[model samples]
Target: MPQPSVLIAGAGPSGLVLALVLLQNGVHVRIIDKERTHRIGSRAAGVMARTLELYAQLGVLNDILAVTSPFGPMASYDFGELVPKSKTAFLFEHQEPTPDIPYPNTEAVNQTKHEGVLREHLAKLGCTVELAAELRGFEQSAEGVMAKIMHTAEDGRQNEETATFEWLVGTDGAHSVVRKQLGLSFLGETRTEHVVGLGDIVVEEGLGMDVAHMWFINGKMILVRPDDVNNKMFSFLYRTSSAEKPLTREDFVEEFYRITGRRDVKFGEATWLSKYTPNIRMVDTMRKGRVFVAGDAAHCHTPTGGQGLNSSVQDAANLGWKLALVYKKLAPASLLDTYAEERMRVIAHMLGLTTALGDTNRANMGKKDFKMQHPDAMRMLGVNYRGSSIVCEEPGAAEGVDDPYMGGVGGRVQAAYRAPDASELVPAGKQDKTTRLFEMFSASRHTVLVFGGDAGTRAPVVKALEHFPATGVIHAVLVLGQGNATPSDAPSFATVLEDRAGHAYKGYDVDTGELAVVVVRPDGVVGVVASDAEGLERYFKKILIAA
Candidate 1:
């Protein structure tokens, strides 16, 4: 019943995710969608490793894993041939799980189911998406944002209501009303020459579910991928000429038969169907005043690397915690500006990457010898905010590194990088069992990790953190060396762990006996890497408001 602090104008995965992050941080939110019902389709189905790690932080990994499957190999067949001519290499190389990267592979799950899981989590947090409620317009002042929302009743009557909130986020797809109203220039190209018909359909038999079936016929490509574990449902993407009119289920069926020349496969009803033309566009900036944009609203590209939905979710994650801190008066409002600063560059790089992949895909449609391979960068674990203004790296740390998609598996541990997970840590009193660094991370606060130092050595760092609120905004974790005992003066609120197997030290690149401190932001990004309390204080000063 408390007035919502944030108004999110889309209920897709991006909006739902932002709402969940804010709710977890105790920030109330109102998420609205213009559609009467959630969309159904296998639109953006590839969930990458980086997204999986983020899902873990939000406590939705188990549910997501339940409904998703690993990316399967693409099996290409010659036209009119039932047998596959060749099995194209896996789009991404299979990497085994390591201590640093737990989720090493991409998973496949439709956008609809993905949104459902996120919505379920939001409901548990006591928030629901306001269906049939459309954000018509909004105006912002220095204090807050006043939004005009149009609500439709069951009988089709409509009423416009004015609502006030501290912040507004537009996650409302590519045709974002928020972006248009804000007058943000969406500068990019739309490739009308390339069009594809996409939909999910049920096939009773004559298709294997383990691999994606691909056929290049008459200078067009038809890619059919298994949609579910039941083996009866599948999703298809059919390349169509610009001359062709908008496609229906009947048209899709007719084309499928004509393109593949397969009569043995029995077709059932199509669950969803639509035409897709790569928009390949992005806003000049993700923010304008108190209102902001994320997901497809900010940038949209071809789904070549399966990065669209994942990048959108990442955009929400980056903005969510920053918004919460500013809303709670824990951090300065200027902190929200960093959202556009960090995400815009990354989205630009993503657009280029997907565009190149799409170009390659179109060019290689009929090339029998071409093999499709996605670069490891598509995993997104390598994505970093290396040059972010808020991140601080101490003297002698790696500097001048230009790679944004660096530092995932086997990469150096430094400031502004994704904080790698460390396992086999023994808690203060529990020698029989152990936990991981990820288990200690919370979406609600910044985690200050004090590594390899005893109580006397770490006392300065702990004392410095005392300047900030300890209840919900900041937490300290002391990771002692293998033989080091728990510090006698350790703060009651601090968690003490022993790096028995050195996994923590190795993952963090900290020497066994060297003392170090890593400040991890609420979004699981390493905010700062330092050797002393002064470094920790300086980083927090940039992030938290002075007490």
Candidate 2:
């Protein structure tokens, strides 16, 4: 009998990522796509720093960054002249290193190219994206999820196969078959007033194709960024009405002229042109019993601020670990609800923001103040789970105090709270900080930041964890800043940094005197915040242990 596990539908960025994660953590996953063969379709160009951190955990970030470099800087254009380059210029990084936000800013590469990199990684994990197999129907039961997948064989044959798994995830694009099959309602609008676009073309030599250049030509906006991997191939984002229906190669040419104000532009060839009528909508619920939805299946919107693909990738990251726990029997399956509950807010927010940005396109606002908590800023990595059922109904939601990204809701103010004592987790007399621990912990899991001194005081926490390791509960980190050499019983060990001068602690915003801890889920969202190890333990029991 096949193992009861996850059934992931739609192999877009989110679905494919969910497959990679589950397989890595020992969960069996079968991913099916509606299309017969994967086509290098549209470009989902923007990748946020937090998403990059998730990719780093998946272990392909370095390779991804290497393949997509040397894209000139990000430039704003006034008329035909270039303004100052953007601070977030690095294709694969926002800022190299920052003590506040562990992740970098955001990165950009065509969706086709990015998807290719993901496919390569997925192949290495003993899973292949089964093309042509479409999820046409599914039945969810307490036992497992059985899906009817339709596919046409290479011999020009047609077949329907029923596959059974413990759970099903829909990652299909905007018009999701799984959503329709489940009778779920996608609540929102398909009101598109202007036409948005994307295409790959060659630019005039030394037009500074090295930098990601944006031109707000009159009211239409043009965003062009060179693919570091291929100089001849550059991705362009703009609005056009050159064609009443779908724009063509000539339309792209004319639009480029309209924006660049230079009809002298010539191109060698065209790779892809995709036109999307912005539909800002999200499913009423991301989860219904054993079936779940993600990515475009759960939420899609106008590509105005470029948050659709970023948010979808984030949804994948959030669900991957939780679903793994379900498969491992570490927690009751109900724990999976957190995926929908937590990610729904993200999707809803994106839809709201994108819709607003779409409305403002006629005015063509420049830059939109990256610092402002404008909905479009969600394009950066600032999602949270403060009001989540998994957040233990913590007291801070009203004032917006405790959730991760405490910097402020909608990413308003960054985590401005810094500790007075920079060396929070170092031994008193010994020059040891938890820098290595932070690096290693950040490498794999979104670490639990323990702040109170001598975490061993809460020995019962370790006992509880050891007692429930089979239950598949929360992963714990023992943070000790000022005092200790060892942990008595609990999983308490202060961060031991390479240099004890407190450089690393300062890097992550941990102060010696602050007696607080943050529960960071695998997807990098802060699940809970507490005063001490006991609070941390309470969070573990609440969110991690048996459903």
Candidate 3:
């Protein structure tokens, strides 16, 4: 086979997303997994806000929303006595949406269904998952990777082929062959005593599907939440006693009845059942030469904060655009290094947070006043890449990071933060309706927004950007005041837009008559916040190559 631009091993969420995003950008990718069948289970059930935004860009968010609902309110009982409302899970109320942040709440969805939605969209994009194809081994050179993949036939025959690709990404799970072949260190801890038994069961009697129910008794915590499926279906996760033997579906049901002390809540049969030891492990590095590791291949933690799948999806989102740039030769290979640097810190922080939450779980096991609390940080909107070498911040600013670019360069804003979403952008020649900054971003290329500047200040910036040969990989947009018209001398290559409601300027932190330039990366991060044409040129010169 001819070498693809990229080869992806493991058709899980991370690998599938990486393939779809790359394919959307016109990059050829081959994605394969060792599993013979699609997954079936309720694993990793919380989808954070950041992942939702990325899903919107991928065009699958609405479909996912159609199949999911807000996490039902959590109800806890102590020996049949109901706990107070404050003690329920989700410690914080859902954050009200602001103009700058469209998605402020998490959606409750399982891993299996989420992957199914992603695969459906990938098929629509003309790509299919090659199942029963395992990555046996590989060797990497400066030019690319030669991988040996074993394909299993229906007749029980196996055929191995050696394929070459410019890049190889391992989105394989924790026990990843790619990570093992690369000899990367997955350093962390695992505790056999901390075991969680989970299952999907049909409720014989209707337990109000509007709320998640839980019981704490005799050193155990049992939780039940509604799934998207109808017919009073619920997914359960419970802690097994450290001294208890291996758990079975009958054990879970018996314990559930014993704790609640109620025969009214009954289970007919379990659709899925499994037991797992809680483990927290992460790769020291995400990339080595031309091969890379993402998702569980890179990090795995207890699902306390539901960060597993969300973090993995973000990892693919972060790496997808950078890989495409390198494949097109529009950016240098060093850009890939930022993938490790940026993701490592976030994963480390996530590990620490989830570990602490696991400790909370153990502590609250037998307590009468157990509170199932969720933290605000779990939403994952605060992650940023301010300290990265590629992120250029203006001088005399807050130094490391800024809160909102709407505050301007001098105002408080992080240079490498996720660019805030804004609305009321009128695309040129369209007057009937307005658009959004996210709609313009779309993750295909870098987006340059020139905010509230006169032609004198904006003209030179546009001209200088046109002079750069990297226009194919960088998109330029001019956001003028509601009354100001596009200057006749404006760069013909640039897209002229009107911020009629002033949300763009306000959200991006530029005052009327004051010139500001915000450069958004393909992954929708604010790359640089500059004040002039010279600053814009300087930012691009560091990341882009001549066309």
Candidate 4:
């Protein structure tokens, strides 16, 4: 077999996602993890809305939703109280699904099963994560990267090998060897004042599985939530000022009974136990030469808002398409620079949001204020890349908008925001069945939407798209306004559709009879919002290589 184009240093969600994206785009990838076996604990459990949308594009959302549970309410209790005081507080409130936003509520699934679903998808694609294969070191030049990989056998045998690939991505986590080799500054502070103990235990009985239980006694706190449907397994977090020594299952059991005053709630067994020290850190940049770092290796913060895994997955999604385009020679290497430019801004904003949530949790130690509801920003639907170096915007466009986390949806549709979904679109000359805009999106290609333009107005825009590769790379869709018939002169290369309910026009913020062009990138971000053919050509010029 030929050498892989990319070597991913971690097999966690971020690495798996990046590998899947590359393979979907017809790029070769080899993903590796240092562990001897797949992980088994409920590390990160919350899956946000934006992540679910991305999974839908990857064709794994159904499997994920099939096994996961919706984010439920939390039952709060005071010191030594067997009965709960309140049961209305929620980590994330459920929102009704709108035409534009399909998965409006957060879902809960442990990291083990979540990774299992992703690996299953990868297996169907003829790729698997190489266990026990660790990236020890790597050196990158202008052309490719030379990596040293350490492989450990099951019986304690170890061997080192050298390999070469076009690019190396580090998703090896916070203590990443790849990041340290690159000498990037991980600038941040470690919170030493508090330490958290996390683990999974089997509860015999007496706790309901529908709600997460939280207990506050004197100045101590412990939160436990059901992990499986059987209500036998649960995940808990105990926060304290200090733990001079490592904690055992006995210690956790003793503390649980002491805090909750519920000795009747017997404990069976402990599945896993670990300590967590809150560290707020991020790298200045994500790339250097042919090497790049993403996910936890790039940034890590408190897991208060369930943004760590979601942000990591988003980072992979943002970089995967650009890397594929560059690898295939369809786009210039400069296109890869925008990956860092776009994601770093979003990561900075996310770190602040999660840190604030952590501070609030710390401040409300003994109070009855544990009824926390995550802000809408946690959904991440409004994160935008307005004013990006590669995005093109028409005059009077909302460029450099300050609302990074809560703009674009139900607001003016801008150039670099998340593209909203539109339904009730009928193919030209057919009204039997309708399709949604999201159904036409794919991770391997770009979607160009021409909204409500006359034949003469659309001819030039359609002609501009001919400059790029047409086979599985760039797809053009012509969306006509309501009550407008498809013109005979419509371009044969484009898919012509009629908006029967005007959802396409309304969701995109385009007026009827308006001549506008919107380019959705492979990652479902609005890359360009243009008024005419000149704007379209100018935008693609920055992305595609010159003929």
Tens-place lDDT per residue, model 2, 256-285, is 776776554566566777776677778888
lDDT of 4 by residue, 1-547 (tens): 5679999999999999999999999899999999999988888898988898889888889999987898788888876666789888887888998778889899999888999999999999889999999998988888899999999999989999999999999999999998999999899888877688888999888788889998866777798988896748999998855667776899898888888888878888898888888889999999998999999999989888899999999999999999998998988998899999999988888888889887886677777565554788888888878667888755655544466676663576678888888888998867798988887777898888888768877788877887777667888888888888778666554678888888889988898777988888888888888888888888888888852
What's the true lDDT of residue 444 in model 1?
81
Tens-place lDDT per residue, model 1, 373-487, is 5888899988888678888864634466556676633566778778889888899888899998888777788888888755677778777887887668887888888878767
Estimate every model's Cα lDDT from 0 to 1: 0.86, 0.63, 0.80, 0.86
Model 3: weakest 10-residue lDDT segment is 402-411
**Candidate 4 TM-score to native:** 0.96
- Candidate 4 lowest-lDDT run of ten: 393-402
lDDT of 3 by residue, 1-547 (tens): 3447788999888998899889887798999999998877788878888888888777788988876667756776666554433334653357888777798888887778888998999888778899999999999998789999999998889999999988999998999999998899989898777788887888877466777877777776788888855666788988765535665678887888787765667777787888877789999899999999999999988978788898999899999988888887888889899899888877887888889987886787766566665677788777776567778865654464433212334434447777888788887777887888877776577888878667776777877787666635778888777777767645554677888888777777778788888888877777788888888888877777762
Which residue window of length 10 is worst by lDDT in model 1? 393-402
TM-scores of all predicted structures: 0.96, 0.82, 0.92, 0.96
Q: What is the alpha-carbon lDDT of model 1 when measured against the actual structure?
A: 0.86
Residue pairs of candidate 4 with colliding backbone atoms = none
lDDT of 4: 0.86
Whole-model lDDT for model 3 versus the true structure?
0.80
Candidate 3 shows a clash count of 5
Which parts of model 1 have CA positions greater than 4 angstroms off? 243-245, 394-401, 408-410
